[model samples]
Target: MENDEMIIPELNNETIESMIYIIRGQKVILDFELAKIYGYETKRFNEQVKNNINKFPERYRFQLNKEELDIILRPKKSTLAKRILKNI
Candidate 1:
């Protein structure tokens, strides 16, 4: 089978900019935000990543530590989990 490059959808500049944040002193966007920008369901996006794991570097993804999660989750007036559920 001939290999074909997958085309990533164009993202709105403002929308993409807004999703970027500094976490652990590194600029990043959550998997969910990236999936949204790429017009994918978060679960499917993640599954694709797993299937093509070698395509991404270690720094490309990391789980939030407890302290980091607390710092982020605490400030949000609303529960992030609920917000995520509503969107999906």
Candidate 2:
């Protein structure tokens, strides 16, 4: 195989599985993790999502409330909130 044919080693089934979470009783992946998969920074990826918001319907995307966050996240609520705020 040519050097260009070599697979990128960082991507694996285990890593992909690790990024998925159950939120609001749905299996979902966060924007930052999706951004990494697509080789874009989180902010840039979110900007694209915002620009194309109409293309994504309600079933496709939604924000979490504090109650949903508590159920989905294992970390302390304050710690996760701080991390989320930093990403925003």
Q: What shift in Å separates residue 41 of candidate 2 from its native position after superposition?
A: 1.4
Task: Compose the digit string of candidate 1's lDDT tens values, residues 1-88.
Answer: 1123323455567767866778988988877777665666677788889999999888888878877766665666386656566557
Please identify model 1 stretches exceeding 4 Å from their true place.
Answer: 1-11, 74-80, 86-88
Instruction: Look at candidate 2 and tell me the lDDT of residue 87.
Output: 67
| Full-model lDDT, candidate 1 | 0.70
Q: What is the C-alpha RMSD of each candidate to the true structure, in Å?
A: 5.6, 6.1
TM-score top scorer:
1
Candidate 2 similarity to native, TM-score: 0.66
TM values, all candidates = 0.68, 0.66
Which lDDT values do the candidates have, in the order given? Answer: 0.70, 0.70
